[model samples]
Structure formats: C-alpha cells, structure tokens
Target: MPDYNGSVDYLKKAALRGSRLGLERISELMERLDNPQNRVKTIHVAGTNGKGSFGAMLTSILTEAGYTVGGFSSPALTGITDSFRINCREITKKDFAEVMTEIIPHCEAMEDKPTEFEVLTAAAYLLFFRKGCNISVVECGMGGDTDSTNVLCFPLLSVITNVQKDHTAFLGETIEEIARHKAGIIKCSRPVIYGGTDLTVSDLILREAKKKCSEFYSTDYFRVSDTSSDLSGTEFSFDGMGDFRMQLLGKYQVMNAATVLTAVEVLRGQRINIPDEAVRRGLEKARWHGRFEVVRREPYVIYDGAHNPDGIRSAAESIELYFRGSDIVLLIGVMADKEYGLYTDMLGSRIRKAFTVTPDNPRALASDKLAEVFRAADIDAEPFDDLAKGVCSAYEYAKANGLPLIALGSLYMYGDFMDALNNITE
Candidate 1:
C-alpha cells in the first residue's frame, strides 16, 4: 500500500498529464466505483468567487444542525487532504493514502486516464459515502458544465454565488459565456439559488433553471445592513433571517452571509429541519481562511487570496475600509495567467512598498516579473526567490516602517504562508 507522501507524488505526476475538463472520465470512474455521489445528498456550488465561503457557511450550519456533512474545495489550504473534509475536519493522511490505494488500480486499468482533479473528485464522493455523511457541500473546480464536480446527477440544491469574468481562457471571454458554463450545474427540478445581480448572468441562470423545471431563488432582494465591523469581525442583519456575527472580515462577507441565510430558508422550504439557533451559531463559527485573514498581530500581518479582478477589488475595499489612514505594505504572489490590470488599479494606493514572491505552483508568475508589474505602478518593489525569505523581509520592513503588511494573491501559496509564519515566530 502506498503511504501518504507516495500517494501525493503520484497525484502530482498525474497533474502533469494536465486538466481535461469533461465528465466522461469522471462518469466512468463513478460507475466503476458504484456511483457513491448519488448515494449521498450534495449541494452543488459554482461561481467565480465566494463559492468557498458559501460552502463553508452551509457546512457549518448543517453541522450545527447535527448532520454529518462533508466539504470539498480546491487548491487545498491544508495541502491535498484539506480539499476533502467532513464537518470541517480534514481527511487524515492515512485515510487519504488508503483511499488512493483503492482508487489507483482502477485508474491504471482505465482506457483514458482520469485527470488529477477528476480522480480526486471521485475519491471525495466515495469518501463521503463511506464515512456516512448525511450531506456534502461541493465546490466546482472551474466552469460547472465540464468541471469534474459536475458529475452529481442530482443535488439537493444548486448555488451560483456570483457570475464574473474568471477562467476566461476556457470559460469564455464574456460574462455571459462564463455564466452559461456556471449555470450548467442547475439540475432538473432541483432548487437553484443565485447570489449575484449581473442581469445577464441572472437571466441566463434563471432561464436554465426554468428550462429544467427547477425552483429559482435569488438573494438580490435580501436587504443587508452592516451593524458594525472592526478588525475582529463584522455584525450584520439579513432581513427576517435575524442578526448575525461572523469573524470573517469584509463587507463582501456580509453579502455572502445573506446568501447563506437565503440558502437556509430554501432548505427549510425543502423540509430540512434546521433551527434558528443553529443558524446563529453556525454564522458565528463559520470560517474560510485566506480571504482577508489576519494571520499575525502587533505588526499586523494579513493574507487574502485575491488572485483575480473581483477578489482584488474586494480585498482593496476591505483594506481601505479598515486601514485607510494607516501605513500599509503589500506582499504579492500571483499566477502567470491571471488578469493583473485590476491588481494595480485597485490596490496601488494602499501599497507603501511591495515584495513579490513566486508561489509554489507550476503556473506561478516569476517573482521578478511580478515585481516589474508593481514597479510599473510607481511603487517600490523587490522580488525574492525564496517564499519564506520574502515573507520575513516583508514583515520586517513593515515593522520597521510602522506599516501593516498584507500578503495577497494565489490560494496555492497559503500553505507556504503558514510555513513562513512558523519560521518568523520560532
């Protein structure tokens, strides 16, 4: 049997085979594995952004209601295993290795090998079913139509957190094109909820749901009022859903929370017995890291996974809202393919000095090239080859200058952030 490291290396090599976005390989794997996805109820989440946050919130609410729920998200914050978790507990390395052991032989026998993401998605389905999860919240890897996670035949509900320009290379260049792919997750006769107000995107999703005879609900009507917000957290009220508080910083989070309440109401309509107390408790406890997360205090170190335009805008807004008058420096690492115009346009004003590091990923943009982008913004920029060294240098500079430091960009770098922070504290 393969150990954890061996299993991870095998998947890494499998990733080199590249991502083939379609359901054929996944469908075959599911059929061979006895279709465990259908055995467990799932809530399909797809969108350019906020899918992770929404899934985390729903998982917390369901767990608070005493149901065993599994959650699956991408670019695993805790490495590969964290991508598959139950009730917020990451799958153990031992369990992951054992599952890979069972899944590998089947992969080897396949005529057309499954993509790395497809294999992982199939494994998550089997893991959720075998672990006796009453429910699971699954986020699509990319566009919904061909994403590996779209294999769910029927979901309890389908959620599109928002529609935006992302993954344009494959999802298409326009908002409508990207939205069509995202709307494909709307299963027949199932309830579908959308958290975005882009009229074109909403209309497409609504039409798709209507075509499939699915009930459609949009959270656009929900009124959200921010009661209070500080570095600690935010307090808000979503119409009749009652007041709630969450440690997740940013006004955007308030929007995500409202969408979550709308989902709870939809679940209630479906006869799922979730109590109000559970909703309140769940909101208070729900946390999805790497989105405007403050990792250290005193000198103030923050981390945000704002790899794209929308995310960059949100992080910039939150920084302005929280630290407008304070001195702030930035530490950035982004993908080679991401859109960068918004990065400088949105965050340029807040940056005092910038440190660039190449994230630990195959597609990461070179640190020096990223620094060149920063320098174009007319901000002082420096590049470091070693991520940990760059992080320490950024923190030290921030400390000496009496400025807060925010590390932003690719989610793939979060694991590296923890490692770098450990080196600093130790």
Candidate 2:
C-alpha cells in the first residue's frame, strides 16, 4: 500500500528483514531487469575474512592498469555508499539513491521479496554495466554457494581467499561444509584462484574447479622473503613480484597482497595487460579503512574489524608483533554467534584491561557477556551499558596509563565506536 522513495530510508527498512541466504530471489529480481550481470565482466571474491582487502588490492592494481573498475563489498563500513565503488571512488549519494530508486519497485513487487543484500547485489550489477566499467570485482556477502552475488552469469575468475569457521549456523557446522559453500562460486568453467592456507579447503576448491573443468591456481607456493612489518604496514617481496608495500597493517595483509599478485598473474595469463609496475604502485596505494587502521597517536588507538576467531588470531599476531612490550588496552564488541573463547585466550595476555560494549546491531553480544568472556581468560575486564561512556572511560584509562588502545570486533561497531572515540578529550 505504501511506495518506497529514492531516500536511503527505504534501504534501511529492507535491511531489517536480516540475512536470509539464497539465490532464487536475486535470480527473479535479475529477470525483471533483463539481467545486467550477464552484460559485464566480473571477478567474484569470497572468503571468511581478508576478502575485502584482497578486492581492494586487486581493484587498485587493475585501476593502475588503466581500467574502470567497479567494486561491491558488504557491511557499508561507515555509510550506505561505502559498499559500492567505481574506479576507487565511492558512488555519490545522489547516484546511489537514484539507482536504488529504479531497483526498489521491482523488489517491492516481487512475490518472494529479496533481502537487502540481494537488492544491493542487483544494484551493483546494474551499476557496473550502466556505468561502463571495464571489469568489476564483486565480494560475496557471506557463504559462497547460496550468496546472492553467485547469480553472476560468468565471471573472469572466482577467488576464494580463505575458509574458516564462521557463520556456521547458515553455512554449516564443519569446515568441510563451509568449504563446499565457498566453492560454489566456481562456475562456467572459469578459472579459480584459491588463496587459503588450509589444505583441505584448497583440495575441496580444486575438486570444484575440476568439476567445472576450470583452471586452479594456489598461493601455497608463493614465497614471502626479506619481510619487515611494523606500525608503518608490511613491506616484503613475493616470488618475483618484486618489492611491495601496503598501507594496510599486519603480516596476514602481506599474504593477502601476495594472493592479489597471484590473481594478477592469472589475469595476465588471460591476456589482461596489468604490468608489474601497476602491481607495485597499487599495493603501495591500496587502503582498506578500519582494519587495523591507526586513527590517532600519543595515547594510540586503532579501529579493527576482526569479528571471528580466525580473523582475531591474525589481528592478534600483528598486534603482538608490532607492540610486543607496550601497554595495551582493548575496547571490544562481538556478534552473538561468535566463539569468543579463542579471542580471550590469544589476546588476554597482551591487554592491560578490556572495556566492552555492545555493538549497535540486532545480533551483538551484550557488553556484560563479552566482558565475561575476557574475564574467564583472566583478562581484567569492564562492562559498559552505554557505548560512549565505555569509549570515554577506555580512552581515559589508556591515556592515564600511557597505553595504546585497540577497538576491535564486529564491523557494526566501527561507526559507533569512532563517533564516541572522536568526542573524547585528548
């Protein structure tokens, strides 16, 4: 009875239905618009984490090679427009509103309504083709097989960054099940590049690629040598790709960069003309905001979005390596489905204290419960009922003790945490 408008408010309403992973709704929605996904060339990226950073790296290098690259990643980090990018620039609010306006009616009219991610995927497809992109790198929202983005007709290639235990309720209960879900993107006999370290996952992906009669490339043999990592980000040489540096921190990021290079090699094999210089320049310029991003100095603070145990382990490795003996405090929040035990076990010994707050999401773990997780690991923990107070208190404690504070977990928390952190007095 009510009509949706061009305003972002309508998109917010669509998102409230939450995540229901499937391809059927998106398939029908694409049919309504004559299927824009089939008109464009795309590279599909899927993983539990680091996939966004990998996409960003690939986008930068491709842009350096003189292509108009469209990007679609999830969670919208700071704003609704953060999910969509063309040639490394975000789609303007005006353009985003206009595009969604055209697509909203079809979504509203669908008998089986599409989820927000499905609508976003369709919008990205339409935007990529309509905007005249040479090629676009699209990241999956969650598990690969049933993810709405899998509706792609035929992509240049499929990249599976890594498979870890995450979104278990939706994906499945085991790593094998999860790997099967991620391997779903291999289609149309397109080549696949597997970047995961897990042998089982890689073998599973290899089987899927074989089933599709597709070529498969793995990052397993790539040697990273003469490496150095600190607060300035990682610098290393990868198996003849030459020396490279990425502004994004952590050693895992170095591996992620190497994976991008592996993909670039595959692209070059397909007659794409990405030069060695583009790879070097792009890695130096690639910036994926909020993953181990340092937002302030003096009493230092970082904003990281390490939500799962595996991701947290990677982040923890980088943090420990960079600030081995320094005084550190943690400001954390997490989702309801996450197993927080490993988070505490790995990070507890390094933190002076932890201040916990609930993220502003429907599935966020309560602040008190998160604090309980930390305390069970012998971490000194404080719980806050209000996000701002928690941030201010954490800031004050870190400042008083001359410690660096890390605000970690849930991508949902970064927007709110940064807003609160900005208001604190230095």
Candidate 3:
C-alpha cells in the first residue's frame, strides 16, 4: 500500500498484491474518491459472455456521438494492470501512477487497504470524472449485486448481455441464480436492456425487470435480418432501422448490436439525441482485444480467450462458421477453477489436434492436468512446460504441419501470448 505517484512501476507494484474478489474494499475506496461514479452518467453492463464486446460497442457509439467516454474493462486484453481507459485510450502509466498517488492515502485512511480491483475501479471513475467525461461504460468485474461497479446509482441503462453457467462457485450454480446476480444491476426504475438467447436466463431477467417496472428491450423482441460475418466485420439489417455494420464479427454480435441500438433508442426517446450516424460509427469502431481476435496472417493465427465451456463452445462455433473446412490445431491454457472436462469436450471434438499449457496465474491448472482431461477424452493433448513454451512449440508444430492454428482457454494467457507474438513479429 505505497503511494502511487507517477511511477511506471505502479502497476507492477500494485499487481503484486494480486486479485481478491469481493466489493467491500472497492466500495470503501470509492467513498474516499468522492464517489465519482455517481457524478457521471453510466451504462452498466453484465452477463456471462459478450458483455465486454457489447460494452466496447456502447462506448464506441457514445464516443461517436461526441460524448467524452470513460470505459473500465476487466482482465485487460493485455496484462497492463488497471485497464481503466479514458476517451477510448488505456490510462497511461503516468496517469495511473498519478491517480494511484491520489487515491492510495485515501484508501489507506479507510478501514483497510483497498483490494486491487476496488482501487482500480475507484481510479477509473475518479480519472474519468477528472478528465471531464459526460458518461462512462462500466463492465462488471464479477457478479453484479455486490460488484464494486454496482455502486453507480441511476445508470442511464443497465445492460445484461447474456447469462450463462460460469462462476458457479461464487455466483451460483443454477441459471436462475446466475441470472439473479446479473439482474441485480437493474436499478429500481432505470431502463434495462436484455441481450442473450437463453430462455431460462432471459426469463429470470424479465421477471426482475417487471418486478422493478424497469423497461426491458430484448433481441428476441426485435426483428433482425440479413446478418452476415466476414473477417472485415459483420453486416446486418434491422427491422425499424435499416442497414448497420460493425467491425466485430459473428452472428452473435448482431444480437449485441441490437441491444446497443435498443439502448440508443431508449436514450433517444429520453432526448439523448444519439444520431444514426453516431450509432453506425460506434458499431464500426468498437474494438475489444481478445474475442476471436486474428493475431496473424499468412498462416492465420487466431486468438480467443474462451475459458469456460459456454465460451469455448461459442468460439468453436465461430471457428466452424468463419474458418470452415480448414484443419485446425489448437493451443490451449486455462485456470484451475473452470470445468475442464466440459470445456475440453466442447472444443476437443472440433479441432484436429490440441496442445495444453498452464497460464502464469497461480490459479492456473497445471498443463499435465489439462492434458489428462483431454487424454481421457481420447484427445492427443501435448502438454508444455508453460504458456510461452507451449505457444512457441504449437506455432512451430502448426508451421511444420501446415495447418490453421487457434490459441485459446483463458484471458490470463493473453498478455503472455500477445507479448510473445509481438516479440516474434519484431
């Protein structure tokens, strides 16, 4: 808990303390930051998947409409700690250092030192408020009810992207329980946008929204058509709205875009004046780092941080759709908390060969453990010492074998993979 003044080492030092899930520490820290979250209008987004990309899309459109946008995303696509961004740029090291300096003593003065996530959340809002952004798009770090970001009152909109079964240990095991946690973001009277396909989960959300009398807009209620995905982006047609395009690929984004558009329409009805041009521009510019990100050309290296089974299945489907008929070699690493058998079962049946490695996080599942899971499934999983060596070996194997390759499993692997990939390119 040292002062964070303008040191490039702020993250390295702060990151050392590591992640501990829970929001009481963050709630306390934010109170010391003058609760900047309340000063700005916010669009609170939470779901099992696609919420991050949806948040990116929301920020993009809000920015295009000339709003100074503040964004806070978790598990930063890269390892840069405190991926708090302002006006669409990652908070610079100097800014991070300065803000940490400002908030540290306040955090220390509190009952206890703030947890990393709490400090980061407080820093994001304080920095955004200081930078003078009109609105912020905040993605929940974990569940919604007690989530640190949930402190925002009167968020312009609460977006529940999609609820799926992940984080069963902390959140809940049943879909209803998971939905309840996500639906907790719905303010008493604020507009709530629901954008996912699971009926059981969607039903839980709708039930909550009705109980609160919050207006709900769902993709199932919208008339969407002519959706297409290519490497460039996705092109789609809407019912009330005509043609719209987004830089993000896959059919799933069409629903995500619909959710964004639905929120925009609600905002417009409330006299927000978000022009169609802004909406189009926002969809075009939305850039989330790791979801089905194509990292290389020539041999077509792709990266997807699909740690859970639902995510892995979705990524696999996207692969079959986008890179159909191409033989695939997968490079994988995952955390210990996830359901390994389910995840591997969903992905193993799709790819030709698989390679396993453990991520750098202490919570990571050992490579041998992952190998055993795949092997039991009759998959020939080659275990590597670590992510770096695994990725290198996989890349070489793919090169020698002349097949398309995919690197996935956990977002924790992204920083190392991205760093390694960059080094290779350089």
Candidate 4:
C-alpha cells in the first residue's frame, strides 16, 4: 500500500493533466474499478455559489437523521483530504492511501488517464460504498453537464443553487447559458430544487426540469418570516417549519437555509424520514468555513472566498449590514480568470484601504494588477507578493486604526491567509 504522501503525490501528478471537463474519462475509470458510484445513493448539487453550504447543510441533516452520510466537494479548504468526508469528518490519511493504492494501477492502465478531480471522485465513491454510507451528497466542481461528478446515472435529488456568471470560459458568458449548464443535472423523473431569484435563470431551470419530467421546487415556495444575522451567526424562521439558527453568517446563508428547508420538505414527500428536529439541529450545527469566517474578534478579521462578482456583491452587502459606519480594511487576492474589475468596483467605495496579494495558484492574479484595479476604482490600494506580509500589514492597520479587516477573493489564498494570521497571533 502506498503511504499518504505517495498517494497525495500520485493525485498531484494526475492534476498536471488539468481540468478536462467531460464524463468520458471518469466513466471509463469508474468502469475499470467496477463503478462503485452506482452502488450508492446520491444528491447532486450544482451552482455558481452556495453549493458547498447547501451540501454541508444537507449532509448535516442526513447525519443528524441517524444515517451514515458521505460528502464529496472540490478545491478543499485546507487539504485535498477535505474533499472526501463521511459524517462531516475528512477521510483518514490511511484510508485515503488505501483507496489510492486500490485505484492508481487502474488509473495508470487506462487508455485516457482521468484528471485529478475525476480520480478523486472515483475514490470518494469507492470509499463511501465500502464504508457503507447510507447516502451521499456530491457537489459539482464546475458546470454540472460535463463535471466529473455527472457520472452518477441517477441521483436521489439534484439541487441548483443560484446560478451566476462564473466559469464563463467553460460554462458560458451569459446568465442563460450558465443556467443551462447548471440545469443539466436535472435527471429524468427525479426531483430538483433551485434557489436563484433571477426570473430568466429560474424559468430556464424550470423548463429544463419540465423537459426531464422531474418534480420541481424553488425557494419561492418557502417564506422566511423572521431573520437576523451578525458576525456571530444567523437566526431565521421558515413560515411553517419553525425558527432555525446557524453559525454561518450572511443574508445569503439565510436564503441557502430556505433552499435546504425546501429540499427537506421534498425529502419528506419522498419518505426520507428526516424529522423537524433533525433539520433544526443540522442547520444550527452546520458550518462552512472560509465564507465570512471570523478568525479573530479583537481586530475583527474576516476571511471570505468571494471570488465572483455576485459573491463580491453579497460580501459587500454583508459588510454594510454588519459593519456600517465602521472603517473597513480590505485584503484581496483572486484568480486571474475572474472579473477583478467588477469585483473591485462593487466594493470599492466601502473600503477605507486595500491590501492585495497573489493567491497561491498558477491562475492567480498578480498583486500589482489587483492593486491597480482597486486604485483605478479610487480605493487606496497596495500590493504584496508575499501573503504573510500582506496579512500582517492589513492586521496592523486594522488594529491601529480601529477598523474591521476583511480578506476576500480566491479560495486558493485562504490557507496562506490562515497561516499568516496564526503566525501573527502567536
């Protein structure tokens, strides 16, 4: 059996092939391994945003309902192992190594070697099947139609959470085109739930659901009667479902909860046996890190992976809602492919000062270029090639000036920012 480092290295080598979006390679690889994905029940979630939050909430609810739940997501927060989880815990290094040992030879023998994500998806399915997961929740890495996770033939449910203009190079440039890509997860005769408010996007999804002959549900079906949120947490009520509270902060999270609650109702209709108590407890306990996550309270530092335009707008709105009248320091880093101009423009006026850093990725936008964008938008901006220095400067400025510092942009930078914060605090 391979050691953990060796297995991780193997996966990294596969990643060198890069993101080839299609199901052919994954399907062939899974077939070579006897297709373990077919043995498990799955809920497929696809969207530009909120996929992780929705998946986590659903997994928590399933686990709370006393089922062995498996969860698969992508671009893990801290480590690759975080992508494969059971009962909210990442697969142990030993288990990850064992699974890699079992699959690497098959991967090597394949005529067209699978990409890293495809291999990981196969590994997750095999692990969940072998470990006896009662149900599995899979979040699509990108567009639903061609994502590796689309290999699942029939999922228990498909959720499309708020389609936005992202991954335009692959998905599409227009919202309607993007909506079509997200809508591809809807299966024949299955059920689908959508959480987006855009009428055009929702109508497109509705039409796709109709074409698939699937039962459709939307966030419009649920009414959020009362809602309150701060950096600490969010509390809200779903008309008849009762009041729920969660550690995840933001108005968007409240909408995500409404989507999950609507999904719970659909699950109940399908006789899943999820009790109201389970839903309440699951929402209360479910935590998705790196989205408005507070790492320190004294200087009031927040880290959010709001890389896209819509996400940046939401983060800006949350800042206004929670820290209005306070000086806000912005620490930003992002991938080169994103609309950095739009992102900076959306939150520029609110930012008292900006510190830009390059995220740790090949596609990272240069810190100097990001600083230029912020400066062009009339926000005071500075650039740093080193994340540690950037974070330190931001923290010192925020503390000295009595301002709240927010770190936003690419998820790739989160680990670096977290490490820097820990070092400074220590």
lDDT agreement of model 4 with the native: 0.89
lDDT of 2: 0.88
Provide the TM-score for each candidate, comma-separated. 0.98, 0.97, 0.93, 0.98
| lDDT of each residue in 86-161, candidate 2, tens digit only | 9888888777776787788899898888877888899899989889999999999999999999999789989999
- For all candidates, the clash counts are 0, 0, 1, 0
Residue-level lDDT for 422 in candidate 4: 90
Off by over 4 Å in 1: none
Q: Write the per-residue lDDT of candidate 4 for residues 1-426, one digit (tens) a residue.
A: 568999989988998999999999999988988988888889899999999989989999999999999999877888888888999888889988988899999999998899999999999999999999989999999999999898888888999999998999998899999888888889999999999999998889999999999999998634896788887788888997898899998668888888999888988887899988999999988978888888899889998889999999999988988898776999999998998889766787778999999988999999999999888888899999999999999999999998999999988778888989999952
**Candidate 1 lDDT for residue 200:** 81
TM-score of 4: 0.98
Candidate 1 per-residue lDDT, tens place, 203-305, comes to 8999999999999999954478757888998988877777889998875888888888999999999888899999999989988889888888878888999
What overall lDDT goes with each candidate model? 0.89, 0.88, 0.79, 0.89
Better of 1 and 2 by TM-score: 1
Q: With candidate 2 superimposed using the best TM-score fit, by how many Å does residue 302's alpha carbon deviate from the native?
A: 0.9
Candidate 3 ranges with C-alpha deviation above 4 Å = 1-23
Task: Rank candidates, TM-score, best first.
Answer: 4, 1, 2, 3
Model 1 superposed RMSD (Cα): 1.3
